[model samples]
Target chain A: VARPRIEQAQQHLDSLTKPPGSLGRLEEVAARIAAMHPEGKPQIRKRGVFLFAADHGVVVEQVSAYPQEVTAQMVLNFLQGGAAINVLARHAGAEVTVIDMGVNHNFDRQLPLLHKKITKGTGNLRRGPAMTREQAEAALTVGVELATQAQRDGIDLIGTGDMGIGNTTASAAILSVLSGHAPEAITGHGTGIDAATRRHKVAVIEDALRLHQLDPTDPIDVLAKVGGFEIAGIAGLILGAAAQALPVVIDGVVSIAAATVAYQLKPDVVDYLFASHNSTEPACRAGFQILGQEPLLDLQMRLGEGTGAILAMNLIEAAVKIYSEMATFDTAGVSRKQLP
Target chain B: VARPRIEQAQQHLDSLTKPPGSLGRLEEVAARIAAMHPEGKPQIRKRGVFLFAADHGVVVEQVSAYPQEVTAQMVLNFLQGGAAINVLARHAGAEVTVIDMGVNHNFDRQLPLLHKKITKGTGNLRRGPAMTREQAEAALTVGVELATQAQRDGIDLIGTGDMGIGNTTASAAILSVLSGHAPEAITGHGTGIDAATRRHKVAVIEDALRLHQLDPTDPIDVLAKVGGFEIAGIAGLILGAAAQALPVVIDGVVSIAAATVAYQLKPDVVDYLFASHNSTEPACRAGFQILGQEPLLDLQMRLGEGTGAILAMNLIEAAVKIYSEMATFDTAGVSRKQLP
Candidate 1:
């Protein structure tokens, strides 16, 4: 962050028609964006949401409400612009890109899909590590490559999303290892599972955590042992955006797990990332605590398809507009506050 | 609220690609809008924000940080599209209308103004009632009349905002009576007051509340005793919107004070109210508790110029689009969750 530009932005915010420091977080958002683009006008016109679609082998344990096939089907729905993500992205004036990372299904050749498959799917984590260390690294590499491509294609803002069934199990397991919280303490009913299914899911995650004995210090170890392929991809996206000095907004629990990994790798990446919301997932709250990034919105959304991320685009744009357009008290001939 | 249409909206939400209720409050918003329209499509194309500008004679008590004249100046700033509300309303695709309810200063005839002045300004509450019962009624009538005009002119949504110096003290006084909280517990550093000034502001509210001994059941008596002109206007706007069955998005503390009064008038008006964000004001939080309404956003914003209300228009529009668009499970051939 550029200190001079941030100071300048704060000065500008103070001079607005309203009382000084009255705009609250909106002013902070403006200051941060000003620091991001020191030239001052940090407009977010070309926004893109990278939807990483994959399937988790852990669903074989019946941990999720929906079937694994729903992941691939939703990917297709996203391509056809029939999903919640598609609706929200369109509303936010952002383009959506569906990345087929490891869906365990084939897509039509004519569809606008980014083929970055690390594998068909990872091994079931209830027994052992979900994927080898090499495969985890490869998935993260793909995310970085996709983010680089977006930045090269004139995308100013990137939003991270996932479409993997039973991925919340993986996210919870990873968080349990990283935060040292019990599986039941961090687990939530992903996709609205029943009581028995939730208990079963918790038992599966506890088994996975014990079986892998993952290293808390090493995020890659955590990802290979418990995280899903799309989670690794999202981690890479955050790292790539940070390296390129681009802002990346992350969605829900899955995205938070990825952000945790990215933050572990490079603490500076936290500056480049924006948490879209504090999801209903109990583990997501733990992940945010570990990262110390407050979400901009909290609608209790648990659909991790960049829906929350895209909704925040409006707020980000409003902050930029207020920073760039609103006249100062001096310019507008408005009187300033009288201090006693 | 239409039951059949709300049921239909819920069915549509369930049939979407994501899990049922994964959209959370967004789904609830869609159902409410569906109930409002009931015929199927609920659109919010035309949005209007009514900024009621006025002045408070209580500023003579030195309870505010800014001079009272800034109220009229901000009214001009709003008209010139140079205020924070103007910037945010433009960003949210909403039109801004500045109504001169009781600003102490005069405006140029060339300027576009509602010119609905009830009085020059309210009497200092520390001395006596802010306004006569008749003036309080008239100011509220202005709000209803303005809302009716907006609805007739094709505004599908109404957002209420207020700009009046020392209004926060008045708001705290109103809430202190309604919520039965002590003055210090409800008062805050409105517009960034110093430590001594904040103490003085609380003392002023305490005196006003004790002097009036206002009846909580009679909202009109409370407003007449301590509320500013713009606050009454906003109360009237909420009543008018409810009478017309129009959705009214309300801004921060000042707006909530108005809402408290309006709710007291007609409890059914709560059905039409959408809280934009929870303000940082301690009294605003208590006001929301009294109204039993949870805000959609909480940005810690203290600038009460309909900025938060305008920002909420984006979320409302997104909900409508998601309800009206997005292929259902049957239409898109997606599978639903299997409940045990």
Candidate 2:
């Protein structure tokens, strides 16, 4: 973030009507937007969310509660505008883009898919790496290119989303490696698994981390060893947004894990990112801790269709509006308190 | 709240596409709306918020950061649609009604004020009781009658807000009396007071509580002894809404103090309340703990012009819409997971 712009924003906010620092986090949000673009009034007039839909080979471990086909089905659901993200994005006045990163199914040739599939799906991480290092880099490049595309298309703010069944196992494995926490400690019942399935998922993640023995400092190695293709894509998106100086709102655990990888790659990405929710997933908290970012909201929502991103977009818009529109104490003729 | 409708609402929510209880507090919000209606659908199409602007003689004790004139000035700001509440209420699709419970200044007769001023302001609680028992009961009756009028005007939901200079001092006093906490423990800087002013505010509250020596269980006695008119009005609004089965969203610490008093008067009023934020005020948390309520959001907001209530109205509307409009698993043809 630009420190000069942030200081300017704070000074501006302190002069607004009502008490100094009274608007709380909303004031911080306005300052963040100002830091992102210091020259003129910053606004989120055009919003775009990239929903990276892929299949996780880890599903073969029976770690998730739902079938893998739900991933492709949800992608179609997105195109048909029937998913939660579509509803919430519309509510937030944002557009949704579905990127076919590594789904196992083929779509119609005419469908509006970003079509950057690195592979049909990632390899089963329990026995081997989820993907080749080259594939991970390619997925990350896809994210970078998509973010550039969004900015070129006049998208002011970007949001990260994921739609892949059993991807939580991959996310947990990545988090366990990065956060140095035991797999059981960072694991949660993703998509509402039963106790037995949750334990099995934990074991799968534990086994993957033990087998991979990847270096934590190298984000690409982590992504190739245990991360999903969509996760790498999300990381790429974060880097792309940071390079272009656009604010990106991150969704839940999977997205935060991606952001963790992105932050490791380019620490400046942290300045351009806004976290969405403290998801019910335990791993998400660990990932956020690693990134040193606090989520703007915590609704206990685990339905990660970028719903949290959309809800946060509303607040971001409000922050920008308040910063731009609210009359200052001088303009409103509101008297300041006399301190003793 | 209607128990039968709450049961039916849970049944309906279980049939949704997401995991059971995945939405967390949002589901509880939907359930509350269902219980309020207990019929085909519960919707808050017409939302109303009452902003009770009053003055407190306790300002003579140097207990507030802002001057007493701000109470009436903010009321005029509300009437002119130039305050935070106005912006937020428009964003939430809610209407605002400024009720002059006891503003020190008089407004133009044609300025659309709910003019029910109770003696221009309350007496200094440091010297004696804030108001007589008859005046406390009268102010509460005004709240009851206003709620009835709102329901008659087709307002589906109600929100509580306050605009008083030293109302937080009065609110802290009420909370200190009722929760058995020391004044220093409950008192916080209202409107961003300096350290010395905050300390003095706490001392004034302590002196008032000792002077009153009122009964904690008797809410009316507590209000008559230490509460401001707007606090009593909020309590009365909550009770009236509960009697009519309307869900009322509360703003912050002052509203929580009012809700605490209402909860004491009729414990079932808890069922009809939707808390807005986990205010930064320590007394607000104590008040919520007393009422067994959790706020829906925590934005660190301390501004008390119904801004929090308006933001909460947006979520309440979303909850109602999701409950009534979102497709169920059976309707959406989404398969449920087979649990072991």
Candidate 3:
């Protein structure tokens, strides 16, 4: 990150119409974006929300509230601009890209989507590895390619979204293996499951963690062992955004799992990342703690289709507008009033 | 508020292509707006951020970080569209209105603002009443008139902002008297004061509260004794918005004080009020708890220029857009395969 540019932006913000640092996190956002530019001016006009879709074999254990088929169905919903992500992305004027990473169902070849399924979803995670190491690598590679495609399309900012049934279980399992948090403590109601089902979900994650014994030191081992393909894809997207020096607003639980994967691989990539909101999913809190960045909003949103991310991207735009449009003390002819 | 309309909107939201209640507070916003309209559909396209500027006689006690002159200078900044409120309101596509209720500094007759100076600022609260009861009523009438003017101009949503140098001290006094919290407990650095100055500010408020012997049950007496004109103006705005059946997005410290006054006067107005963000001011937390309404955002923002409220208006717009534009499960051919 351009430290000098960030400092310059803060200096400029202090000279604007409000008290020093009174704009709070919005000012930090503007300063962070200022560092992204060469002239110390923040510019993030174009945005894209990448909605990765896949399925988890652990649905056989009823770990999720929705069925595995809902993943492909929601992918179709995204292609039709009918999902929650599409609504929010459109609100933010961000383009939506639906990537089918490893959905069990096959989408039509002409569905105006990227069909990159890896092994038709992974083995039932409660029994064995979710996917082989090579499959996980391929999923991450897919995310990187999509992010590269976003850059080629002149996207200045990118957001992460996900749609995969039984994925929260996969995410909680990943967080448990990596962060050493108990699965029962981190697991939550994915799509509003009952208490007994939640307890069962926690148990499934525990069994999967015990079965895999994934290496916490290696992000890839953890991802391949327990993470969903959509999760791995988001990890790839974060790394790709970092490589391209574009800011990425990460969404809810599954995306946080992906962020954890990306963060473990390269801690420095945190600069290019923005935690969108505190998801209701407990694993998201654990993931945020591991990633070490505060979210912009806390609306208790946990839909996980980049809805929170896109909403936050709008705030980023507002922050940048304030940075660019607000008159300085000299221009406004206001005194630089400060307390002694 | 129309409870049936709110329930109808919530039902509509559940039918959309996401899990029930997954959108969290955004869903609540949409439902609330839906209750405002005749039909169950939500609509809040027009927004106005009312910036009420005044001065405080308590500045003689050195309770604030800036000078009393800053009240009028910031008012001029608002007039010239150069203040933080101007920048943020422009970002939200909301209109900015500068109301000089009692700024002490005389703006020219031709300055495009509502110059309704009640007493050229209130008396020193540490020694005596902040204003006569009649003067407090006049300040509140100014807010009601502004809100009514907004309605005449087709603004469907309104926000409250404050600009008075020592108003936080006045606000702390009002909150302390009303909620029975100590001056030191709710007092904070208004415009970034030093520790000794903050300690002195608490002492000043304590002295003022003691000198007034204000009635806790009577909000008007509280306003007349300790509140600034801008605070009264915001209280009137909240009441006016409720009368017009328009939503009021309440801003930071002074606005919350105004809200507490409004809530004390007419508790049902809480339905029309949206706590925009959790203000960093400790008094604001007590204010929210007293009002019994949760803030939409918690960005640690303390700038009281309706910055947070305007930002939150953007989110409400997003929520309404989602309500209006998203496809339903039936429309999108997605099964409502929710957990039993």
Candidate 4:
């Protein structure tokens, strides 16, 4: 039933009276939604962005130069609307909610913070599993709850973004497991790390994989063993969004890894996923390919503060508007013939 | 006097609260404006984007696969808000007005059109000068008038974009003479032309330069010989924007060439100019250096429909809002230093 509805949406999009495939990946998203609700018009009236923040215990391994404190600092930056994500979100006309899935610091209760701590950050993933299976489930449950609540508040399009120090290493590990690639092929310099540090980070990821004896077949199991709480939460957000037939715009590599895990859990979930942009990170391209999605923007961006997702949000609005507006060529009374 | 204003603006931007010199080229424009009006705050409240559309007579030389009619077709596309520039401008919150500077077609009277034809698009430059000095001046005057009207409408920013087929060949020719480089160095595969067609385009430009005996030192002489009517007009627009103390965001290689000519005319005009992005065109980077301006974005974009400028417009708004709306440390009562 879901497959036919998805096909119906795509057929309606193909008939929308513009140059076929001119809108790029946006056309794919519009079609996917059209298929989701074949009986009604596809609409994105209310949009919500979920910013999941956590601390990565891999920072303890000196993989990143920035202190774990920067994660909390950036979370404050987001709350105060001082980050690039804030500016882009305001421009995209989307409401943003920051969730403290698992941060090391004690946050103020009045800051609209959602307390969904799986653990006081993950255990040092360089040594063993970042979080237990039970902890991963708890974080995923938190994400599910957040998405359900957003849907109740009338959100039809949900975007996933994340904030954490040294999390890119975790994302690379997850990508390797999901894409069946080696660590060297996916690991990259995150947050201005030098070449030597990058090599060390890759080694740490490879070491952790061997220690945990992580399986490539089960993505959630791999994530539970090596991913940050925020990454697991975002994966759950992707699932929750798809379960409700809402679209999820995945951000950079970390969010991409999350979406990959969610898709592994439910292949049908990809019917509701749209990749926002290609990150400079090599892992991002592999992740996008694994999910069979093409990113809309390629600005060589690697700053994973949801900047790519925010930039791609405007195009989604344009796509949906084209679906809803723009009279057909028959109505516009313009000839389709090539000019003489 | 303009020199002092530019220096003052640069110094003021340097003094702003943030990482010093971290904002890159954006800080340069803010500083130039500070120098322009030492006592007044720099403001970019109202913006006008001029999209100059024309067809190159050189296209008749078999230098391009698409006929000249595609120029007019794209112009119509711009007016209908179907082009990439239209989408980006809508996101940037700028009003776009298309000028039919020299297209060889009669637009319907009912359609929105600005007729400033210069000899129905200049005679093929491969034979001689693309246009007469008088015709070039007339086209430039049209641009001046447009800028004056934008000023009257309370515009504080002016941007230049163009839609002319085969203009890259002309731009490469002009850039070669202006930058004292050979044509081959500046020329690129414009509009995805085949390798064979590109060689022909390069040869055409070289022959045109030799036939005209264009002097590299004289900017106006070089422009009259190889520049498009729209290119000259854009150069005039940059001067007009600078004359009014408004920032002018330049689009791609063509717009950068205009900025170069404008700077040559009045070095202080560089104060009001901002390079929107570093184009993939080799000539554009040289033009930026020649004008002593840096681009806000470096996306390797070569699309000359003002898309780059539109992308940067949002960043400008963000920078200004930060400058105007962010509370000072004293006012916000937030500690600037780390807590003891």
Candidate 5:
């Protein structure tokens, strides 16, 4: 039902005054929304970027080269508008909100912290499940609450990104379980880890799968057992965005893993998920292919501080504008060129 | 001399209030400019993007699947705000001026076209020289005039981009001749050409090299014989921008080839050039390495039409803001953290 409508909108938009397919992926997105609500224009006035920050217990395994403290430092950097994501978001005119999902540090309650700590961080997944079923649910609930608040604020477009050191290992574990791929196939040398460290990271994910008796076919169970708090929260955000009819620009491999979980939980949620870019991670291409989503950008970028999503914000805006403003050929008094 | 000044500026900027080397290449750019001026803060204002359009005679060899007619069609696309470069330049708030360096069509004399056509197009480079030395000089002179006008209009920053369907082939030929690399090493499948077509394109360039008796060491001679008019114009634009002390964001392979020629002609002119992105073109890396410049971005982008340069405009703004803003640590009354 959703696919037909989106496709119809795309067809309508393509037939507008400009050259067919000249707007590139922007045309695709605009058409998708037109299909979503065939009777009215799809507006993206209140855009919100939800940045979920947490601590990956895999940092305890010494897999990441950077100290775990860099995660908190980067959060402060984001607040101060010094990070690349901040610069990109500012350029796109997107409102960014940071969530301290389960970071180890404590901040003043009045400092706008969401305060949804899920066990202060997951235990190192090399030994066991990152979070129990109850904690994962709590994290998802937090995501739901965030999305609900965004909807109340009239946010029509929701983009999900994350900041968690060593979370790539968590993403690989979740992806392996969700996509039915082996750990080695989905795992990558995240954040410039050496080959030995990457191999060790893969082994840790494998150990976690065996310890949890994870079922690759069941995404929710996989997320509950192996997903980081931020990953679960992003999944919730995707589901919530879909429930509210808001589009979600899922960023990179980690976000795709979250989207997979969200789609598994609610199959219709795929309508709201727009994969932002084909990340450098090999698993990301497979993930998008399985989900039947095409990314707007194909830069070999793997720096997952929501950089790719922020860049895609401009493309999304262009799509919405074309949908709203582009006059049809008849209205613009332009004749279509006859096909040769 | 430019290299040392840029290095000095980078060092001074690294000592600013924020974390050392945290702002990445933006800081480096600002610092480079600061070192060049020494007395006053480096400023970037009144930015202009010169979109040089031409038709390559090499298109006669079927080097590009897109017909030569697409060149003029895209020029109209640029004027009508339907091209990717137009959208991106609009987003960056930079003014664009289109120049018909050597289009195969004639227009009203009263139109704003710069009558710089060396020929209807280059001579089919597969057979002989693309342009005579006199024609190449005339094209370069046109670029110089355009830059001079931009400077008079108070533009402190200029960017070079090109629009010609078969220009990538020309860029590859120029780069191979200048860098002494085999054509196959520098040539790529431009605009989705098939492997067989790509090989043919490379062989055509190799044939051109043999027919012209081109010396790999003489860059200007190579460019004069094998480069498109737009490339010659861009070489002049780089030199013109340097003469005025204005920074120019050099686009991908074609623009880099132009800059290489300009540098060979006037070694000191390299001061004004900044590599926008290391394009997916294999020759681009060698070009940048030869110029001793690092690109601001490396997203594997091969789409010319100034998309990469426009994308980098935001980073330049960030760098300039950091150079001009951001209270020093002493002024902010914040103690600097001791290095670990």
Candidate 6:
């Protein structure tokens, strides 16, 4: 971040007609965006949602409510523009692209989606590693390459989302290993699971953690052990967006897992990342704690497909407009604080 | 609220592609909007923001940070489309109307604004009644009449915002009387007042509450004693929106104060109202507690001109689209949970 530009943005916002800092989070968001640009002006002209789809071997443990094949089905639903994320991204004027990282199914046709599958899915974490270290690195590299392509495509901002049947279990396992929190504490009902299934999901994550006592500093080792391909891809996108000075918005739990991996891999990556909303998922809160950031909206949304991120992009745009469009007190002839 | 449609909305939402209630408050908002319409479908085609501008005599007691004239100046700022509210409302595709409700100043010529001045301003509550019971009623009636006109104009949704230099002081006083909370707890720094001035503002509200000793049940009596004209107008517009079955979004502290009055006047009006965002003002929380409702956003915004409400309208529109646009599980060829 351009640290000095933050101070400059604050000074500019104070001169606006409204009370100093009375805009609250809106002002903070605007100033943060300003600090991102070289000219100290924040503008988001084009936005995109890079939704990565993959399959989780952990689904074999009966951790998720939906079937494993639902991941590919939802990807097709997204391609057809019949999903919640498509509707929301359209409302927010953002484009949606499905990045096929490692889903268990195949399109087997020329589809309007990125096909970069890594062997249909990762191995089940309960038995051993989810994927090899090389596979993890390849997924991450693909994500970085995709972000570079987006930058070339003139995208000003991008959001990360994930779709995998048991990805939340992988997210919980990652959070447990990184944050050293108990599985029960950071595991939640993913895609509407019953209480018994939630307990089982926690147990499944606990088993994974026990099977692979991952290193906190080795983000790649951790991703290779218990993380989904989509999780690694998300982390790579975060790193790539940070590398390119492009702002990235992190969505719900799966994205948070990716963010946790990215933050550990490169701590400075936090500067370019913004949390979209407070997801009801427990790992989301824990991951945000590790990032030391607050999510913007608190609507308790847990759906991932970059839906929450798209909703928050509207606020970020509004903040930029508030900073750039609103007149100063001098220009508007508004009175200043009396007896301040 | 058409209470049965809430269940119908739930049932219908569950059949969509995503998991049941995964959208969180978005689902609740869509359900509430669905319940409002007889067809059990939610759609927000035309949204408008009704902004009320007035003046408060409490500025004489040194309770506000800004001079009273800033209210009129900001209103003109809004009229010029250079205010934060104007920018945000335009972004959200919502139209804004300036309603001059006893703003202590006159345009004297025709302007593109509503002229519903009840008086020069409300009398200082520390000394006596802010306005007569008849004046408060008149302000509220004008608000209702405006809603009726909006209904004729095909506005399906409306939002309430207030602009008055010292309106937050009156709001704190009203909340103190109605919620039985002490002024020291509910009163806050309005419009960037210093710490010492905030303490003084609290003392001023405390003095007004003591001078009035208002009845909690008698909303009109309470408004007559301590509330500002804009607050009454906001309350009136809320009541009018409820009468017309039009959804209304409540903005910040001043709008909360008016909502407190209207909710007390007719408790059923909450069915038609949605708290936009949790304001930085302490009184807004107290008011929402009274209404037994939770706000949709938590951006910590305090800029009142319905800026928060306008930002939230984008989400509401997204929620309606999610409810009406997304494909069902059968249509999308997606598998449901294998077992409950």
- Tell me, by lDDT, which candidate is best: 6
What's the CA error at residue B75 for candidate 3, in Å? 1.6
Worst 10 residues of 2 chain A by lDDT: A82-91
Candidate 5 on A97-118: residue-level lDDT in tens?
9898888777567765566777
Candidate 6 lDDT, tens digit per residue, B1-340? 8678788887888999999889999999888888888765678889999999999887899888788888888888988998888988888888999999988787755788899999988999989999999999999998999999999999998988889988999999998888888989998877778889999888888787878778999999999999999999999999999999999999988898899899998999999888898888899889999988898888878889998888778888898899889999999999998846
**The candidate that achieves the highest TM-score relative to the unseen native structure:** 6
Put down candidate 1 lDDT per residue, A41-63, tens digits, no spaces.
77887999999988888888988
TM-score of chain B of each: 0.97, 0.98, 0.98, 0.91, 0.94, 0.98
DockQ-best of 1 and 6: 6
For residue A94, give model 6's deviation from the true position in Å: 0.8
Off by over 4 Å in 2: A111-113
Interface RMSD values, listed in order for every candidate = 1.3, 1.8, 1.6, 6.8, 6.8, 1.1
What does candidate 4's lDDT look like per residue over A67-148, in tens digits?
7877777777777876556755775688888889899888888887676776668888878789888889889888888878
1 against 3, candidate with superior lDDT: 1
Report how far off residue B130 is in candidate 6 (Å).
0.7
Tens-digit lDDT string for candidate 5 (B229-301): 9999999898888887778899899899898888888888877678888777788977987798988765556
- In terms of lDDT, the poorest run of 10 residues in model 4 chain A is A331-340
* TM-score versus the correct structure, for each prediction: 0.98, 0.96, 0.97, 0.78, 0.76, 0.98
- Ranking according to DockQ, highest score first: 6, 1, 3, 2, 4, 5
Name the lDDT value of residue A129 in candidate 4.
82
Name the Cα RMSD for model 3. 1.6
Q: Which 10 consecutive positions of candidate 5 chain A have the poorest summed lDDT? A: A331-340
- As a whole number from 0 to 100, the lDDT of residue B37 in candidate 6 is 82
* lDDT per residue as tens, model 1, B1-340: 6677778878877877778889888998888887898765888879999999888989999998888888888888888888898888878888898899999987886788889888889999999999999999999999999889988999998999999998999999999899999988989988888889989999899888878888999999999999999999999999999999999999999999999999999998888888889888899888889888889998888898898898887898898888888888877778888755
- Where in model 1 is the C-alpha error above 4 Å? A2-5, B2-8
